[model samples]
Target chain A: MSQDLVFGLYIFALATFVGYQVISRVPPLLHTPLMSGTNAISGISLVASLVVAGEHHDRFAAVLGFIAVTAASINVVGGFMITDRMLRMFNKKKAPALAKAGS
Target chain B: MRESLINLAYLVASVLFILCLRGLSSPEQGRRGILLGELGMLIAVVATLFKAEIVSFEWIIAGAILGSLIGTAISLKIPMTQMPERIALSHAFGGLATSLVGIAEFHRMRDMADAAATVVAVAASEHALNRLTMGSLGFEVFLGSLTFTGSLMAFGKLQGFITGAPVTWKGQNVMNFAAFAGVIGLLVYQVIFLTAAPQWMFFTMCAVGFSLGVLAVLPIGGADMPVVISLLNSYAGLAACATGFALRSNILIISGALDGSSGLLLSILMSKAMNRSFANVLFGAFGTGGGAAAALPVGQAAKGYNEATVEDAAAVLTASQSVIVVPGYGMAVSQAQHAVRDLATALEKRGTEVKYAIHPVAGRMPGHMNVLLAEANISYDALFDLEMINDDFARTDAVIVVGANDVVNPGAKTDAASPIFGMPVFNVEQARSVIVLKRSMNTGFSGVDNELFYMPNTMMVLGDAKKTLISLFGAVKGDGH
Candidate 1:
């Protein structure tokens, strides 16, 4: 009923459509990397976690917030790093092949 | 001004994330796309640190540093063959963080409301935590808690720490349904009927969520893991989206939607590849009694198959001018990817053109085979999907099936009564000669007997796939000498 909630719902619906359009085009070759990449991006929850950990509202909340921050940062850091490592392997055979195909 | 800057940063980050996914459509732009995502994450984190509400920095700094160290170690040390397990574990972490944030938010809001009631009118208590926020928080905790345990179960199965067979018992589906209903009932009660938040109800929902996760995934066989992993990825994303509603952060909502849709699409694709609907995979207990019962039929039919040695297989390869290799989860189980690549190289040296035919649902997750092959230093250009290379099988002189069975079975196309009858499979039978490298005559995870193994032109080389491939490679290389 609130204006902000209404706007959030709108964003959620539209972003989902955008996501479908973008993800459907991704080939099966990079699917593993795509999953990990989106996973790392979803760690955007780290933004919320930082506020909870740093707000100093209460000791109990802060402790929970600390763990939340740590867990989310792992996804952010590990997911992206592993994805990059996988993509690097793919690039090895792609560079020359893609060059010839493009020309 | 400060709020505007943070919102602007989130908007920019959303665009970057979208572009990053677009970049993933090809192998050439994949790494650069990941770099864009990393930059977006950095920008979002920096802007959050400048928020006006945050009063302290020590805990945030400490958690981030420790997490980065552990994450880095894991990324650097894990082998590509273990990618499915690693991705499942990462989903668990994502779920854990989302649920913990929801719990903290709920606790803070209750305390703030209590504190406000003493200074202002009694009605002012509701202002701190409204009905909408309560609903989204409940939604967040439910999905986040379930995804946490579900992913861990998937990880355990993939890592071989737990049995990969479908574990079922009497009335398993009924019990799962009850637990799922309980969570929804609790969520509906607290969010809609009560003015005050009850701690017991919320935590009870959390417990039920965890139980539902374990029960739901318990009956799914190892072969159905690609769908399970993708579905969990979707749950983790939806949890984050609900968290965004609780916190009113647009970036969280946008990224969560992207992640959620990506998982949903992949699950659909994976399910289609196996010719099974989502409901069948979730509740059919697909390979439960079928595996043991199916083994008996295979035992009777085994007498008709032709078993060959490495020398015969090497001779077959030597005569062929073109070869296609089909890989499956068996390859991953035996860790034979490097050996596969070596054999292909030897075949290539003798003027045999070798290419890989990758099924969409091969291995434990989507794109599982591609990553393993890439790690083995095989050119991505040599790998073809079912659509690209299915027709080429007829023209090829030989087809080598390494640790793969069901994907190439002719039963999928010819037998209507077969469980996997509608699934698309490679036409290995159409090739001039077929060489199958398997450890034993055991049926695949689906528990179906493969007719391809009994075909006259098909030669079954029984042994450890890696050892067989190594021997075959040696024979081919020796011919050159």
Candidate 2:
């Protein structure tokens, strides 16, 4: 019934629709790069949630915000760390030879 | 009131989520992106709990405690080898959470009128319109539920708990299409009868969606796991976005959207690496029993292949001016990457130019050989691709192959009747001398014996890859060559 509530809901809906549109068109070829990229975005979410929790006067909202903050933080940090470890495998050294043609 | 501050925090969190996504595109700056995401969620959660109107904290506290314990346990227990499975499982959890959120939001909306008599007059006007309005809650529930089941199936398949074969019949595609049609039909019905015939229709749609997940993943084999994992990850993100929409949370919407798009792109990349179409991966029985049944008969005259001892192998390497090493899955299975790297170092010290030649698909997984070498801290410059080093093989004094079978088969390029013919291969036989380390003359995953073994320049160092490499390194060191 409130104008603020209505506006908030509209923003959420618009973001969701736009987000899905962007997601569906993403070519599977770009998955890992995109995942690592989006993980950084998840990190930003964690920061914003923390700041929001700090600024909030309502104890309940702040606590809920904190929980979300923690979850997203773990997702972003651990996700990237694992991704880096995975990427390191793309570089390896060559093997050695066994015998000569005429010994 | 303080709502303004909470709203401001929400806006900021949304912006950070956007930035975090952008940063993750590059390997160099990915860590920063992760940090930004952490900050955003922290802000969002803090702001949400600041709501003054909400009085109860017990439920939230209990939920947080339980979630943290489970999360921590999963995080600590999972091994690096099973990281892909763990990632899929995390996506499943995200999907499950979104689905639950959607259900709770729907229930809350339904009970709103009855619980608060203060808004009865306003409720009557909204109630009449609500009956005709399509609630986001239903959409979120549908998508989230699908994501939850789909991700679980992907995880199971990746973990080897479930078969990675597509369980399809002659009319499987038709059935899948019908399922899609059924979901759409159920969705339309739900929109019209928002409050009526809830249980049966809801359950039916869920079942169809779940079956669709199984159908979508069943056709893909284990070899195409990376693509499947990424695809399921995208589904999980979309589910989260749907939940955000239902709950009217901007932060969730933005973050989920970023995750969803990234997942889709990763899937595309993985598909390209296999040189297969996305549809083929989804429906074709690729890398299944195709390579498992055919066993190439080994040549009885194995005289030329395993004719060299460690000292003989040492003699060849000792005279070489240049040596190029080629490693394969056998290297990984034998845990010989480090040993091979050490041998290369010793060869270089003996005034022999040593370089590593790598094939694109040399190991079990993409970049498997590369990872093994990197773990040994091998210089990045010493590693060369097949195209780059193939020509040099002929000029090199020796080509030492460790625990490799298929990649160096020579049959792939030389034998027209060979099953893997036309597949690109490393020209290991071109080198002046070739030494192969192996425990037996067993054919590789392609189930074909390597023709390179018969080459005059090639000699098999029969033993484990690690042991052979170590012995060869020791011999080279002792010879003082």
List the candidate 1 regions with Cα displacement exceeding 4 Å: A92-103, B194-197, B291-302
Q: Is the docking of candidate 1 incorrect, acceptable, medium or high quality?
A: medium
TM-score of 1: 0.96
Clash pairs, candidate 1, are none
Total clashing pairs in model 2: 73
**Against the hidden true structure, what lDDT does model 1 obtain?**
0.89
Residues B36-70 of candidate 2: C-alpha lDDT, one tens digit per residue: 65577667767877776445555455444555565
lDDT string, candidate 1, B438-478, tens digits: 98887777788888988899999999989999999999879
Docking class of 2: incorrect
- The clash count of every prediction, one per candidate, is 0, 73
DockQ score of candidate 1?
0.56
Instruction: Estimate, for each residue in A1-103, the C-alpha lDDT of model 2 and write its tens digit.
Output: 5453466457655655655455444322123434544543433333333333344334544554455444544554455455555445434234333223222
